[model samples]
Every structure is written in C-alpha cells, then in structure tokens.
Target chain A: MNSDSLWEVFINACLINNFVLAYFLGICPFLGVSAKLETASRMGVAVCVVMLVSSICAYFIHRVLQALNAPYLQLIAFIVVIASTVQLVEMFIKKASPTLFRALGIFLPLITSNCAILGVALFQTNKGYDFIQSIVYAFGAGLGFMLALILMAGVREKLALARLPDTVEGTAISLMIAGVLSLSFMGFAGLG
Target chain B: MQPEKPIVIRKEVVRRGSADEFLKGLWRENPVFVQVLGMCPVLAVTNSAINALTMGLATAFVLLLSNLLVSCLRHYIPPQVRIATFILIIATFVTVVDYLIQAISLEIHKSLGAFISLIVVNCLILGRAEAFASRNSIGRSLLDALGMGAGFTFALLCMGGVREILGGGTLFGVALFADNYQPWVVMILPSGGFFTLGAWLLLFNRIKQRQQRKQPRLQARLQEMGSEQ
Candidate 1:
C-alpha cells in the first residue's frame, strides 16, 4: 500500500536493515548453524524458501484478518501459518530428494522458530507493503540472511585454526566476528 | 496413616527442591549467559537499561503464565500433538501480553517494535515449557519459570547496564558524565549487542574455567587434610 518501489524495498531489506546483522532477528541459528559453510548455505537456502512462502501467506492472512475485524489475531495467525508451512516444506523436501533432506533435515524444523521468518511476515505487514512488495521484501530478507550466514561460515572456517585464548574459543569468538561483520555492513547504509 | 505421614515429610523436601529450581536459573543455568536460550531479544532490546529490563520482564511474564498453563494441561496433551499444542498455548498468551504491553505503555511498545509480538517464537519461553514445565508439577514449574525469568532479567540488566553506560554515557537515562563525555556509540549499535554479549560470555567462560581449576585443588586439599587426621 505504501508508495515505495519494489527495488527500494528489496535493497532496504537486504542491506540497509539486514535481518540477521542489523536487526538481530535470527541470532540463534545464525550462531548455531554457521559453523560449517556447507550446512550454513544449505540452511540459508532452506530459510529463504520458508521465508518466501510465509511472506506470501502472511500477506493474504493479513487481508483476511483485516476483513474479519480481528487484527488482534495477527501474531497467532502468522505463527501458525509459519509452523504449518515449514512442516509442508519439510515434507516436500523429504520426498523430493532424500540427499538434500539429509543435509537440511535438522535445520528445517528449526526454521519455524527462526525469528527471521516470523520477522519477515510481521515487518511486511507492519510496513503495509502490497503483495508484490511483500514478496520482494521476503526475497531480499532471505538473500540477506543467507549472505550473512555464508560470510560468517567462511570466516569461522578460518577462525578454527587461529590461535586464540581458551576463554574466547567458541561462541564468544563467533559473536565477536559477527560484531565486526555487522559493523562492516553499516557501510551499506543509505544505499537504497 | 503412614502414607499421609510421608507426604507431610516430603512437603519439606519439595520446598527445598523448589529453592534449588529457582536459584539455578539466576546463575548456574542462566538463560542468557549460560544457556544462551533467547538471543534475539537479548541483543535486540538491550540497547538501554530500561528497554532491556522492560523486555526481560515482559518475556518473564509470558514464560510464567505459559509454563503454568502448560503444566496444568500436560497430562491431557498427547505426545504427538504436544508441540503444536504448546505453540498454540504460547501464542495465545503472547497475544494477551502483546495487548497488555501496548495498553500499559505505547512508548515502550514502540521501542520494542515487533520483537514484542515476536516473543511467541522466543526459544527460551518455548524451551522452558517443553523441557521443564511439561514434565514438572505446577508449583515446581512456577518456581522454574520465576528463576529462569529472573536469571534472564538479570542477564539483560547486565548487558543493558553496560551498553547504556558505555554507549550513551548514562544509566537509566541519568547522565553519568559531563556533557563533554564522549560515549562509545558503538556499544549501542547492532554490532555492539554482539560485542557486548560476546564479552559477557567471555567473562563467564573465564570464571568457569577458574572455578574448574580450583575445584580439583580444593578436593585435593580436603583429601590431604583427611589423610593427616
């Protein structure tokens, strides 16, 4: 409904306000699953898929909830939709390709709880973006989440070999790396 | 008569167990520093002391109520549908809280943004419900929720206090320094959240490592003293 262009929305969501780094939407999986690049990328793609589906579903659900004069149910509705959609995605992958499923099996269910997916739905609605804009925004957010994940995974791969204090070995070190990454991403501000 | 007597005696044990359940969440099994269960809001709303405290309390409220409800209904919920049921219950309570927060203070609500509603997905709340509440009694679940909630609130306070002090040169909106004092603005930014939490985790790990180191020495000293006696 807003007059913002699709490109601007995409750019804004992807870079200027990255879900993972800027907004800190999905730090759980961002830190948990970013240890290995292969799993991280696959997890990123799986999240992207779920995000897109939930975004579209949210757009329509918002319309319905508005029509019914029941806006209060939006949060509950959005979460239910997201959980079911993730279930559907899980099933589709399980049947389509057992290998890919094996790679992504565990992370798929976790995608339900990932704040980024729910964030996309909530933000798109809060911004009052039209259906097309919502989809673009979702895609952009997904891309941004994936980009951050892959980048972190790459850095962590090397960090594994670096000499570090025993105290700063695991999560503390990764969080520090993410902090630096977030600081760098600040440069992309105002691009849109 | 014998069973009744044992039940009375076990009541005292239950009270002591409740104390342990409540105390563990404050430090040992802290939801933030130790368990690191809910990181999204832990980092997102912790830009300031008030925001951090408010968000922490809000989450604790939800966790408490949901845990109570979940434990009360645990016997009735089927295993296969339990997760779904849990989500539904959590989502419902989250909605109630969402409205409650909005009514109480729009300003705070605005600051929290969608993260307020996002409480439904907070792994800490759901994690506690599924792991602790579902299996525990109502009284124990309440204590567990309180402890974890307090621990979570305490952690948020730690992060918020540090970030606000460094980032804005103030605590809870009161200026801590002169006008010329330069705030470490980075401490309040998105990256600052990561850095601050990481530093806290580092400190926690250091303390834990030191404790592990001393634990064996203390045991050895005790053994040596016993042998001498």
Candidate 2:
C-alpha cells in the first residue's frame, strides 16, 4: 500500500510464487489431508486463519527483537508462539465446530508443524514487508496453499477410481499431479 | 505405517538387535521417498548438488542432536508437554545451525535462507522424536536418527544430482555433457523440482513392485512343487 502494490503482493504470493507449487512450504497437508474437496477447503481456511494470526504476531515480535538487539530469538520465539497459537486454534475449532473438527482430525493440531505457516512468517520478514503488507502476504500465502490443496484434492478424487499402475497408485500419483499442477502454475510467473 | 508394525519391529529388535532400526529408514521406511515426511527441503534446496549436500548435512545435524536430547529427556517430559519440549529443542538447534551456516559461508547461508530455519518443521525430525526417540532408549534413538537423517540426505542427493545434471549439464559444477549440450532449463525451476521428485518416486515404486512380484512368483512356484509332490 505504501510503496509496493498490494495486488501484486497478493498475486505473487498466491500464484506466481505459490507456497506449495513454487516454495514447497506446505506439502504435508497438501498431500495428506487433501483427498476430498470439502476437507481440503477447510484445511485451507484453517491455515489462512493461522497464517494471519502468526503474521501479525511475528510482525510485532520482529519489532521487539530489533529493539532488544536479540534477533537470534526469532526462530525459537516464532515457533513457540505459532505452536501455542495453533493449540488455541485447535481447541476453539473443537468446541465451536465439531463437524469441521472431525473433518480436520489430527491436521488441526498438526498446523503447529506445518512449515507454510512458519514460512509465511519467515518470508515476510525476509522481504521486509510493513505491517499491512505482511498481513497481505500471509493471507496470499494461505490462499495459494488452499488453491494448491484444492486443486490437488480434485485430481486425487478422480484418481481414486482411475486405473493407475499398482506402483504409482498412492503418493507417487499425488506427486505426479502436484508436479503437473506446479508446471502449469509457472505460467503465472509473467502475470505477476 | 500400520500402528502394529512398530511393535513387531520393537520385538524383533529386542531379540536380534537395533540394527534394523537404523537400516529400515535408509530404504524401506525412507522418510522422503517412501514415507514422504519432509518434502519442503527435499524439493526446494536441491537445485544444485552442493546445495542439496549442505542442506542434507544441516538437517542431519539437527535431527541427530535433537533426537539425542529428546530421547535422553523423554521420561522427564510428560506426555502433555512432550511435543512442545521437543520443538523447543529442535528450534534451539536450528538456530545454532542457521548461525553456523552463516559463519561458514555467507552465500550458502543466504541461499539456504528461511528453509534452514524451517528445519524445525521438517516433520521427519519431529515424527522421529515423537514416535521413536521419545519412547526408545538413547542408543536406539541415536540409531534411528542417524538412519532417518541419512535416508533424507540420500534422497536429497538423488534429487539434487538429477536436477543439477539435467538443469545445467553439470554435477557439482563439473560438466557432464558436451559443451554444446542444451540443458533442460525446467529441471532447475520450481516445477522441475516437483517433476524430478515425482520421477524419483515413480522409479522407486516400480523397483519395489518388481521385487514384490518376483517374491510372489517364487512362492507360487514353490507351492506348485509342494502340491505335485
């Protein structure tokens, strides 16, 4: 908003430089919990919420670390904050929406370990984005992740009945689909 | 894997030894190729052989050190707080590694970037700490970490070697092909990373299937002989 175009930030993070397709930030849930479209979309939303929270938390934390001259605490602080935030999110989702909780299963809590969430925090800081830009970057990363997960889920749903070679029936086929999807995503590079 | 299988491996290792614990992750239970636990670093930093090697070594160091600590302090860490504690230990080591890489080579450190810090979320490391290290004895935990770490490193090397070769017609900066070789530029791009990993997975799957089929065919032939007799 200040200097860099916000739309470009969104597009670059969401498509041109997708967290999953380009950065390989959140492949775990992209491959594991992305079997069904509904679940995949929910997971995507959950990640979006978490990424937004963590990005804000990290932005403030970065300011503090800079003031204290203790930037080394960034990794440990970011992770602990993110992990506990994920726990809070998990409990909230559990009590607030049992159906969504059931759909999420272990993956809700597993968000603590999801690199994409942390990657958003790390990458935004590296890029030196301001508060507004950081939030946008985080949301864009979450959207890109959701986009990748949903696309992969759609393909995998069809793949369940497809006659695949026994060797490539499971993770291999998923990887192949992701590969193709990533290949197509490269076309967006020029758009951004 | 199946929940019951680890118990079976535990029983066999109790009687025979802990060698299988280390050997399994190398191939059978490979964290990357087989289990697919840590895909971010596996795919992201393997654009060059040297980068892959450095990233693998950095991860292995963290995995080994963190596993040792987790295993050593398993009992003191209540189940309620185990994951949090394990992560703290991992983050500490990752920070140390981040600085260490920077000290060694500014370029390598910059190249590795946040992915080095992202090692804390590798899942392979955390998965091992929770599943094997936190429950097993220290000696067994050490072996498990070494094996899984090596398996991850090996898988990275395989991907890196292929990507570097095809992407640039070089292996660790040595030209493999002729001077005029038209390098497949895709191999170095992000999509190339995904495609290369998928190819490796395909190759490993086929090899495993062939081995499985041979064993089944051999068993069928032996059954026929027995019936004839």
Q: Which candidate is the best by DockQ?
A: 1
lDDT of 2 by residue, A1-192 (tens): 246788989999999999999999988888888899888998899999999998999999999999999999999999999988898888888899998888878777878889999999998888899999999999999989999999899888888878877877778778878888999998998996
TM-score of chain B of each: 0.93, 0.91
Candidate 1 lDDT at A166 equals 93
Model 1, runs deviating above 4 Å: B1-16
lDDT (10s digit) by residue, model 1, range B1-229: 6679988889998777867999999989999999888999999999999999989999999999999999999999999988888989998988998899899999989999999888988999999999999999999999999999999999999999999999999999999999999999999999999999999999999999999999999999999999999
Compared with the true structure, what per-residue lDDT tens digits does model 1 show for residues A1-192? Answer: 698998999999999999999999999999999999999999999999999999999999999999999998998899999999999989998999989999886899989999999999999999999989999999999999999999999999998888998999989999999999999999999697
Residue B94 in model 2: lDDT: 96
What is candidate 1's local distance difference test score? Answer: 0.94
**Candidate 2 A-chain TM?**
0.94
**Which regions of candidate 2 deviate over 4 angstroms?**
A94-103, B1-16, B220-229
